[model samples]
Target: MNIAVVTDSTASLPHELRTEHGIVVVPLHLVVDGQEQVEGDDVGTDWVVDALRRKVDISTSRPAPVSFLRAYEQAAKGGADAIISVHLSAAMSGTADSARSAALESPVPVHVVDSRTIGMAVGFAAVSASRDAAAGRDVDDVLERLERRLDASSVRLLVHSLERLRRGGRIGGAAALLGSALAVKPVLHVQDGQVEPLERVRTASKAIARLQALTVENHDNLPEWAGGVDIAVQHVDAGERAQGLARTLADALSTKVETTRLSATVASHVGLGTIGVAMVPRIAD
Candidate 1:
């Protein structure tokens, strides 16, 4: 049966990959200075970074259920028998809830997955699911592969400050880090779908180093069944540092690393100079 893969813009999947896999993307909303714009479309990472630097009021909202319903209908019209809609962490945003609500009214069978992670972590799962569907796998088989990919993926972040996250209410247990020393640089990770503080360092350099070490540790701990891994380096206005980290990881891991800027929606909450790494174990053929 022909199946389609749908994901939100916050997944940060490259446009080429989305086109190659025939994946449908529904954009989230970003409000800057009371002007609500669509993420990645009406607003971009650069614009968001500029707004943040200027201290413009910024906030994000999940796509309406109708937006997802329209996407589902279009996919069905495109000849899809079913669809697997993947989204960022429900704990972080209500996007998954919107997808689930739309699924109820979808013309075709819609299976919504809360990745429990964000950025390329969710992107990686959606890509894998699309491949499985393209290979003629049934819905159950496709979901099985998607789950395996999600289960083996990890995301780590190094943000300049916790202020943006705090303002957006996305900082879970990391809220305590705000009370610590002003010099403390936080290394955070997505745990059980919530942003949690992983380590505290006194310098940004030390925090970045710790972030790379944690990524390496996560890569080393993968099970033998995972044939290989895919790594994505994401940043917000920290291109130089992100490129350096990606190169270091590529050489150390003996694998290719992709570097991309975070989506406007994510960057708004993470703030500028935020660096993140997403590692996903490749499924063996």
Candidate 2:
């Protein structure tokens, strides 16, 4: 049976990679205040970011069931007997739920997976699966690779501003105030499947240094630390800096780097200058 893979725009995959592989990408809506703006439709990343800069309501909406249904239908026509719908973490958003519901109504059998991470973390899983499928692997193999990567992965995000986060209800107004006062650069971590604060520094340079230090410490401790594993370096409105970050990380880890720009959708939440580094942990039982 021919197998197909599907995912949402929140994955923040690069345009080149998405185009190379025929994976179907569904977009989730962005809610500007109470009004709903469909992903890639009524509102885009620029619109959301501008609104946030102006202190406008910056709410995001979950993908509707109909979106998944459409992708499933197209996959079915392309001779897909089975489909794997991968999405952002359920803890962060209800995108996975929409995929599950759409799967139930799909013409082809569907297996929905919650990547449990946003941006390139989710993108990595989908890319891995699509590559496996392209090589004539079965659906089970694709799913296994995805799950394994997630199980052995680490994510670190350096958010430059807390105002957007405060407005989004991620950080309390009080905490945001304290964070700003202390120059506390909160080091957000992705553990198990949720985004949480891991540490806080007093400067932007320190935060970037902290990220590099962690990569060196964790990766060096790995049993199979062959120079470096795949590092997906990303940032919002920092594509130019993305290259420099990648180069610096490569020098520190002595490994190759794959850098990409965050889609406007993810930037709406991470906000501007949010630098994140994600890597699959050293293989462990």
Candidate 3:
């Protein structure tokens, strides 16, 4: 059976990686100053990042059903007998729900899984699903393994500022209050797909160190994604810092990590200078 991979845009995957992997990305919407823009339509990460850098007002919305429907139809037309869709945590966004809704009427079977994490944590599972499906694994078996690996993955975020989060009311006023009084850096983690305040530090350096420590501890001194046992660093316009932190994780985990900046949709909420680490485990599909 031929299977295709589907994921929402919140994963922040690069253009070349998406193309090379033959993965279909369903984009979410972005609203800036009350203007509606669909992901990959009115704007992409680059344009959204530019708007964010200029301090334009911004917000996010669920992807229109049409986009998901269109993507699903395309995958079926491209000889996909079934689709294995891995997506960002349902807690953070309605994208997964949107995908599921549109998939009900698909010509081919679509199995949607809420990856329960974002960035490379989810990306790892998505790509792995793609690989396993291409290798002719049963859809149920592939989905089961992806679920297991996703459960074993861990995500860490070092947010430079909490103003955006506070303004959006995603967090309590405590973060904003502390920021106003004195700068406080917090290490954020995904606890059951919800952003939970893991630890609060005073500097970015300390936060990076903390994340590195977590990766080493959880990974047992090595990554488990079957993708070469590695860690990945994603930042928002924080390439230099991201590189430094990636080097730290690399040494601690004894593996190399990709050093790439995050998408604007992610950066807009986390704000610039945010650094994230994704640690995933291995399981046969």
Q: What TM-score does each of the candidates earn?
A: 0.98, 0.88, 0.90
Residue-by-residue lDDT tens digits, candidate 3, 1-285: 888999987777777778878999887778887887777734766676677788989998778767788888999999999998888888778888888988888889989899878877777777878878877798997888788778778888888777776665555323534444245678888878777687878787888888878877777744344544535788877788889888877776667687765665666777777889887766622
lDDT of each: 0.92, 0.76, 0.77
When 2 and 3 are scored with TM-score, the better candidate is 3
Candidate number with greatest TM-score: 1
Q: Best by lDDT, which number?
A: 1
Off by over 4 Å in 2: 33-36, 41-44, 170-182, 222-228, 281-285
Query: Candidate 3 — worst ten consecutive residues by lDDT sum?
Result: 172-181
State the lDDT at 63 in candidate 3.
Answer: 81
Q: Give lDDT tens digits, candidate 1, residues 120-238.
A: 98988899899888888899999987888888788999998899999999999999888883778889999899999889888998888887888888888897778788899999999
lDDT of 2 by residue, 1-285 (tens): 588889998887776778788778899877665777776633566676677677666667777899899999999999999998899878777889999999889998999998877777777778777877888888887788778777766778888766666555544223434435346777787765666777778898888888888877767776452323567888776766677778988887778778876666677776887888888642332
Error of 1 at 20 (Å): 1.3
Candidate 1, residue 22: lDDT: 91
| Model 1 weakest 10-residue run by lDDT | 38-47
